[model samples]
Target: MRACHALLAATLAVAVLLVPVGAATTAGAPAVQQTPTPQVDDGAPPDRPVEVLTLADDDANRSATRETTLDVGPAVGAATDAAGHELRTIRALARVRGADDPDAALSREFDRIGARAAGLGRQQRSALQAFADGEADARTTLLVLARVDRAARALENRRERVVTTARGEGATVPSERSVALARELGVYTGPVRSQVAAALSGAEPPARVYVSTTPRGVTLAALTESGYVRETYRGDLRRVDDASLTRSAARDAVAAAYPSLWRVRSAVDVDPARVSTVRMTYDGGELAATVGSRNRRVFRDAHRQSLGVAGTDRQAVNTRDGFRLVVNRSYAGGPMRIQLRTVDGDPVAADLTIGPEGGESSPVGTTGPDGERWLLTPDERFTLVAIRGNTVVFITMDPLAAPRTERP
Candidate 1:
């Protein structure tokens, strides 16, 4: 009986091991295998993957990777983590060499700072991604982005000084790869910072953000409920203020830029909190204008003329002296091409100026053997005077007047 009890006890222990903890068995029912549910950290949702876009170093060379989607967080994290490792390695190298090696020390220092800046850039991109994904709020994201911008700008200035010192000492300058890596960080951060600033200033946050990298820098298009808002950042970390022109000031600037246009009307409702794109109505059509912050006095028109004959327009004037002047006007205040030819269509080289005879005039330059000269058109009403060795011909150009077609 004691032997039997020992065997029974052994069997019970085996049963206990087979059954899972916290599992209950019902009498007269077959045992069921219970698979344990996997536990998630902090009970948070699973990771949502996002596609991050990167621009190639050469803008003209297009590659499949240009459109390839990547998980931004992991990609950026890996890059920054690698930079950090590089920094540590650089520091170790610096420590090995004695203090007497100033050149080596300076080179290592330059590399270290570049790595640090790249790490900060990684943080900035992560913050922007979080804000875009609704994982973080605007205020927190903006603060982080602004801090990174300021830090990066300071580092840029510091790097310039280091370059100067390295040149003076005849030491090695920072490697081009390292410099490019640091600048690449700015390319990603600058545009996002601008978007965040716009959002903080009461512009609606974009529903979806699309990024494209270019040779110059980066362009970001934010899709909102209203429409797509596009902005380009060339990696210049300077602070940009919102458009500050009053209605009257904006109108005056446009008028001055297109003085030849009669009844030039300003239709732009200036927004103090955002960059305003100035739109003006003229007698015949409407055009867009961009005002510069440094010189609010000047306005640049946004219209462009096509070079192809399908949509190109031209104005022709005939002189009694058997000369024909063809004006290919560009957008107002843009490059206007003047072609001078004889009545028989022979190209003629002639000197051209802005004003009519005996008026305040400026030289527009001489035409080439092909009888074509491109120059900037004045904003006001002006006469294009062409002189070819005492054979003088002039025509008044008014942008407000519609172009008159000449029969060939």
Candidate 2:
């Protein structure tokens, strides 16, 4: 009995990836998770009519919510108006893709301009030496210096334009067609465009990218029903309007390719007056679901798993939203917290640790979800296990991570 309780407690302690079945079990005692919910004083006073509960529409959203935002559409360049700007990026990409790269066009351009300036500096000394040795022409030396200076300045200006237009550092947003361009950009509208423009004007492209970022069925249910919660998060995939796109073979290929790394969990509930929900949960902790007209699914990258899983029957699920899976035990290798890559591929992982890290920046209160100003260690953890039924990815996390989260 003690062993079973210990295992269940351990199951809750780990942040996620699936745990093996026959997990610690007591012969007769009920699992803590299976225990019935205790009644709360949430019932209204007698004589008051019982009201229906609905997800808040920007008002009473009291879920413990966390969010991450990023934009990872295509990279920002290909300036239309600037004739020469696009040429540079295309050329740079060409250089990146080059085979022999003998001339090294991009680097050569940078070097060529630098070399001219260096040659000019050396010219005066070389000219003096030649003059001393009575082996050079003064007029030729002077002309060489003049030509180098003129050429160097021209190269510098060209380089500056390349930096500015490609990265939007000094250049404007090319506002001439902002309105029309916006529609094409879609959800990656204002901020993404602005960020892209800003990025192009800088030195390097963004360091990362987001493959997906959407919440799912389970996450919504957990958040809306969880006690006194507040959070902001982004999921791995977006639940698009079209089912075809969601359940396409191409997507399945992507999932099976990287079964352990990428997956989906989906579920449907038909209780409480014909309510149906599909939650696609990933080890990445992205949650997304579909209720009615709205299609919800977390977006994430193509962690294509090339190898195939050898098994008699693997779970596969498809419904209104669409999803599939390849099974694998997530935490077999080691213990590491799961994090979803934002559109920019930044770490937008859910903070499951109840340590100082999660507390320091939490908006819940002055200290943290706990009364203590800080959590010295992780009181909880979760591990990724598997994505089931096309849309349900089962996970295990220590409910202790945010102990007293309700207080905040």
Candidate 3:
């Protein structure tokens, strides 16, 4: 009997020891945990709603302006008015194109005027250089310089009018100034015009980028819905709108923000949406997502995955007008905290998910009264996708690098 009792006691001890080891081993496995909601006093003020500024009107105005100025619509009809000014050298140069050429007369005139303009440009350069170098006195050389300047201005005006005419008539000119200069240098050729035309036609319009300098860094806003979030990276923030110019500016802004940390691998224009979808990859796998948008935003992840995920399969419906979701994924790899609030700091309720980076996420059971959730993940590294109404935020967390903070 004493032997049997001793053996039973030994077995119990071994089981207890084995239990702890299994628990510890499974601690990092993906799981979901709910945080208890604190009792609210009836007298406490109701949570103030967050305000998302309306952007539709302003965006429409910008879109119209961009289309009219940048879109290659119908070929501009020939100028109704004749060339506004005549050059003294108009009769000097012979036509490069034969009479059989459709634009023989215009070509001849352009060459003559171009030659005079080039000579004037050379003279102007010399005069400007001499004055800059203190070789010519500001006062003593005033009269001689004035006459030369007047003649040059007259020639340039004539050249401008001719160039305008060429553009109106849908003719290819090297440039506002290049054609004239090239002709004077005897470098004008049929191919030059063709090349110039091709370039002008294919050239992308300037990107409209609005840069607001912040204390930490700069905010590159793209004026697109995707660029509505306010997050920090290398002290800089980013968001976007549409137009070829804005797209380029967004790309340039990201490159400038954290050149050592992130890079824009590609930016493709979505003509239908008039916005650009950009891919920003980082130097290290330390960050999961690096881009933020109006509906959804991703943070810099520890595991470098492309910014923004593919498809909307897991997207959360956002609240139309409420607090913007701010996520602190500073926890090295898995799990992060999410808070819904306005730029001014009002908290609101939201639904959220915590999961492994690029894997199925576990739902962080309903938010507490404080509009906060303790996003839990099984893996050390994870992503949190939060949704409140219509807004969504995807956050990548690195628990290893997460700031050490005491949990209350």
Cα-based TM-score, every candidate? 0.29, 0.17, 0.20
Per residue, candidate 1 scores C-alpha lDDT tens digits across 258-357 of: 4443243434444221122355453333444444443543312222122231112434334344666676543222335688888899999988777522
The ten-residue window of minimal lDDT in model 3 covers 9-18
Tens digit per residue, CA lDDT, model 3, 1-408: 011100110100000010111233346642322212212122111121111111111111110001111223211211111122232424222222223442545566666665665565455445434543446543222222223334444455555565555555555665523432332222111111222222223343222222211122211111111211211111122232322234444444334433433433332221111222234442211221233332222212112221122101111112223335544322111223456666566666767666656677656554666876543222134456655554454444333221211110
lDDT of 1: 0.42
For model 3, the superposed segments whose C-alpha errors exceed 4 Å read: 1-104, 132-135, 140-149, 163-408
TM-score, candidate 3, is 0.20
**Tens digit per residue, CA lDDT, model 2, 143-205:** 232233333334455554443433332223333222112211121111222222333334334
lDDT of each: 0.42, 0.25, 0.31
lDDT of 1 at 209: 35
Higher-lDDT candidate of 2 and 3: 3
Top of the candidates by lDDT: 1
Candidates sorted by TM-score, descending order? 1, 3, 2
Error of 2 at 222 (Å): 16
Best by TM-score: 1
- Better candidate number, 1 or 3, judged by lDDT: 1
